[model samples]
Target: MATTKKYTAILLLLVILGCQKQDTVDNFPIMGNLPMGEYQVGFQTLFTYDLTKNAIPYSDWDGNLYQSPTSENGRQYQINIWYPAQPDSGTRLKYADYINLMGRQTNFGESEEQKTFARQTFITQTRNLKNIRDTENKEELNTEQLNQLLDLDIFARLDAQPAEGQYPVVIYPNGSSPAYQSITCEFLASHGYVTVAFAPKGRFSSGMEISTTGLEVAVDDLEFVLGKVSEKSNADMNQVSILANAISSSVGAAAVSRNEKFKAFISLEGGFISAFEQRLLNGSSFYKPENIQTPILFIYSPHPSIDPKYTSHLKYADRYYAHFPKISEFAMLNYGMFDEFIPDIIGAHSGNTKKGFETANELILRFLNQTIKGESGELFDDSFMSSRNQIDTTFVLPSLPKPPNMAVLKDTFWKEGFDAIETIYQQLKSEGNPQPFSMNFYTEYRDWLAWKKDEDYVYRSRLYDLAYDSYPKSARINYYAGYFSMKREMNEKAKRFYRQALSLCESDEDLSASEKSTLRTYASEDLNSLLK
Candidate 1:
């Protein structure tokens, strides 16, 4: 009789399991969804250009610039964006859409074509957090989540007209990961902030390969992204922040240090590496500014590379943490905290982990809200950690007790960067290289200097003249001249330059097709603006 009862109980359990509906093939549980914030999330892709900057030559592990012949000459980046959505707005995006898109990307393991179906299911499972209370769910996602488990449905309907006005945006510039990891972004969009990520140029996506183009190209594209996003009617450019994880953290940190558009930053387990690791491993062209003004929160794990290494010149990662007083917080995850079993396979460095991603998400949400929206100590003042988290720290320069009330990084190293470019031009001139550079940082330096309200334009003016003289027949120079003249209110001079630039655009032999098209369009715009 007892044996009969046991079999009957087993049958009942099996029946209950069989009755549950599975939203995805990977068996992620059904969820109770709520809006990521008071508002639902919306998404759209934005494309913009850096009329002033040109693309650099891209290299691979096998080739250098000229030899490989692959270059990001036109430097077009497509930004995947998520903002607050309307209650009943456009079409909802599926995790499967991103999965299908990113699954075919190159770096997504062996023979992406063979793994597409399984890969899609795996990605979908990572996001179905409501059924599984891991990855740090502050509360259950309500069943009302609509198409998404949360709110960031791709190209989904959002409150295009939000009752609450505009919202802040977080830029996740150039991550090595394909933009398909919508789950990482959905978490942020769920919390009322517009989160943006770029489809990596070279690695995963079959777009313009910018991976070999180096960090400078990655950093410059950020301004163009910022420019286009600000053009959106719904986005609040005034309260923007930048965030990144792992190797891409360096890109975000380096960019935020230079551009004033970012008011806050979040570095998830990446930014700091010792000087030795910087040179030997990561390449040293990151975080050049000795001091950064924007407040940053560094959520990290112990990298065996940087802090505490005798050669890195940093005793602790906190040394790199030393920037603004009371504005920076450093939280350290235990060594190999993310080095667990399955995550190790996906990407140990990826911030999206079932064990810790939710906690990381919570920390980021509170930190962004407090630093960006609040007036006082909203971040770090309160305990913002999970039991798995072990340490929280902060540092400040002894000289600057408070961030100096100055005009957005008074003395940028860009002037020096131009000097280096000048040296390159002379060498290129000797080598008979017709095109010396793809972009000029000289204009930006001048603008940055002016932002400081400086009287000395003489230095950069001479440098610009040198670049023009070297690349005289260059269409890029003509466009630069037109832009420079326009800024100085020399409309007639600008028109002449724009016309010349348009003519030259057709003849720039070294330019890629995309570059030529971009130039023609920009020159026409310059002329049209003058006519208006």
Candidate 2:
């Protein structure tokens, strides 16, 4: 009887220990659903300096002046990359791992005290407890729950071997916070994209400024990061996209407008913020909505006050605006509700929020697959989005009254001839549009007319007339007019144009040495031929 009792007690103890272990595993703090991909995710943090630009003295998150042991010679960047990796290649990273990286920021080799201070500051800011209490779940959680949140598995491994084959690249510019969108970066990596993000500092400080100069700085940093990521063997630079959040969306829009290398743009609860739209997007010359030819996906919270005029500006790109009803902007980028505090620091906890998060991930993946990867998916179809009650998406094709540029004018000329150019120019001028043709456009059109003069003399002469009338100060335009007039056997008119060309070539300081010499020679020859 003693032996039987001893064995039963031992068995009961074993069962209790097993249950405790299981409970610990279950209590690891859920981060919503696991990454739904075949390849494991790999993460890496790279610290490099852009030698072309100078660094500026900046402050930390706690508003303290950042003093590094070594003086920075150039602009510092802390680039975070997450990519598809070989399964089981490296150890999985904890949420704390990312927080630690966030602490390093521009100072990768700081003292222990500084590192700890930065790390704690990052935790405090990322937690955003006040916002959570006010906007999210108000329930006060126990200390254990908050501690468990840091130990959550974030689904990305550190320094894992990259998977075989090239992957599309998605660049996320987080402004000053390198690890702001950690979950989103890892999610894209798991879905077969090499995601890259960097901490973009301001021109005079470490923190990002809200001015136009600040926006330009962000765009420049993005371009530098693009060059660095292109060096990766597994990165398909040809199929790259920009995935931006909040104010960074304006930066992305500006960057996409300048660089044709980007294949698509994804904005997460961004792009239509009133201040950003007016100051960053509309105010900056770099943010040309008409130049954006790639498709755009805008996932935003439904705000009735949002102006539809912003969407109409994107006349050249296919736009899809997805409105998540009753969902906060923070919830779209994060996962799981109240149970997960670290990932959803400022996020709401509700069934609807969870559904919105999942649907957003699906929508993003499908949109990328269709737009960037050239896969024929149902992202644009109504039925595909109809299945999700949490999301209401509307597809807007390129609209009418396309913004006028050199390319538009050229296309109009090609289809309907020079008469269409005159009509459009007059119409645009009558509408109070100043400077119908840019100086570059005038130069390009003049050169184009010169190249195609022999193909159709009648059409060429008409184009030359338009060019000379628009830019009479251009010596090259006058030379071309004289040549075309000579071709039409109008010797007297040709002589008059040639004389004018020679006078401008001699006096026009704007004309280059080579241009003036060529124009003078051609004009003199045409005038002599007219005399003969």
Candidate 3:
């Protein structure tokens, strides 16, 4: 009887599990999608690149770029793929390879020394975070939070079909995390380029655990993969390029410099000269910048917090830009004021240069269209250049509306005040930071520091009303009002604010999926609840 009961319970559990509905794999999320775009995909083979030439490059087994051809009998290599398939519709594609780290084979039962060296990769160390709770007592991602390990590729786009000759390929070396490879690969594939993502052999998924011949392997694998991609006939092999982010930028620059076939190079948040300097700081980069000859472009962050070493005299971009005048374009992104990443003092001191952080696709499009497509037009105009500069100066600057005087404040003090109190009517505009109080110390008196006076009762009803009145064109302020109304349990008011925010806002990249989903869900739930 006891055995029968246990069997019965196990049977029930199996039935329940079998009956549960799973998430529809076919309806996977395609991230970084712009509203106005066109794409129709189909299923195809996952063409993998080969990298056997870079097996052993570093002789001393220390953490450094290995020269594959000389040190190794030939070269060590690996492969990356761009499969033609629907996003989130099925199982992810996985490949197999041998990964060597610090002269240790990482396949299994590898040497203890190699294992220890592999563990020293910075990315793995940074991703180990202790859990912390938030104001809601819920787990909040803090500074030490493993943003890199947050399953970023959950609904990510995997690959895109490229036009038919071996296509010229471009590879991007990610910063800090191996996850960067996925992000860049997806972008390049979408733009009709074959992207060979590099990982240390045997370290395919674990990007940080670079093999003993990591750099040499990267170069050799890149060449091998380019050949394979070219074999497809649809690929253009002659115009291959390389892109690197942060630390990899240096490696990419050096590798491409030695290999003339690599026509162009791009550095996202990195520069060759300073790369060596930074390597020196971290006790690496044994080679000098002058050894590289690749033409490079750099994309930089505007926030001070993002680039803490801005105050340090290691301005790598400027220095390298001066040296490689013909082969480099040092364009920076510009962030508006009130951003929380970098503080004001450091941003100001660093001259707030290089501010544009365009979406991955947009950046790639601009780069490829300019270099490979060879088209020069008004797209890269001076206005765009100026905007990039403006963003750099104020990336972390908050958004705050300023009023003329108390009388004006009475009628309209805060920028989005009227919109906050009533229905959405017009689009909001913005010139600078929305949180004026955050601009500097003693900002608490900002309210009392009003410049204008209004007879209207702006301050009586709610904060949003006053904010809307003062900065009528500030969409962020309007969004805040909506956000606050939702918090106050004012569903109708919240809906109005959110709708106003959505209607008024022009860009979508800054808004996260959770935030946008919140507005839609709240609006629907509140409507249904009220009806019931």
Best by TM-score: 2
| lDDT by residue (tens digit), candidate 1, 1-532 | 9999999999999999899542231332111121245555566654443445443333322333322222343454556777766665555454444434333222223354524543433344333422232445333222343124222333333224442567788887533222333544655765677777774443222233323244445566666677777877667889998876554555665676567677787766654344432442233334434334566665655444545232132111122231111111121121122123222322223342343444555567777777788845534444543243433454332212222222322333344444554565566556654443323244444566566444444444444566567566778777877776776677897898788888888778746689999989988987999999
Q: What are the per-residue Cα lDDT tens digits for candidate 3 across 24-137?
A: 323322232322112222112222323343333332223455332322333333344442333334443211011122223222224665434443432232222111111222
Global CA lDDT of candidate 3, please?
0.40
User: Which portions of model 1 show Cα errors greater than 4 Å?
Assistant: 1-35, 47-73, 103-164, 174-181, 200-213, 276-288, 308-352, 375-378, 381-383, 386-399, 402-532
Clashes of each: 18, 0, 76
lDDT of 2 by residue, 1-532 (tens): 9999999999999999877422122233443553366667888887888887777655654556666543366887888899999876777667767656665666676466654665566556546643653655544434565456556677777899999999999998874344457766777788899999887778766677667877888888888888888889999989999888767787888888888888898888775545446555666756655577778888877554354456665655778777776666556554324324543455444436666776777788888989888898557587776678876556555533333767777788778877887787667656644434544455566667667543646656766776676678878778877887888877787788888889888778657688788888878877987787
True-vs-predicted CA distance for residue 167, candidate 1, Å: 1.1
Task: Give the better candidate number (1 or 3) by lDDT.
Answer: 1
Global Cα lDDT for candidate 1: 0.50
Q: How far is candidate 2 from the true structure (C-alpha RMSD, Å)?
A: 10.3
Query: Which candidate, 2 or 3, would have the higher TM-score against the true structure?
Result: 2
Lowest summed lDDT window (length 10), candidate 2 = 21-30
lDDT of 2 at 175: 49
- Taken over the whole model, the C-alpha lDDT of each candidate is 0.50, 0.70, 0.40
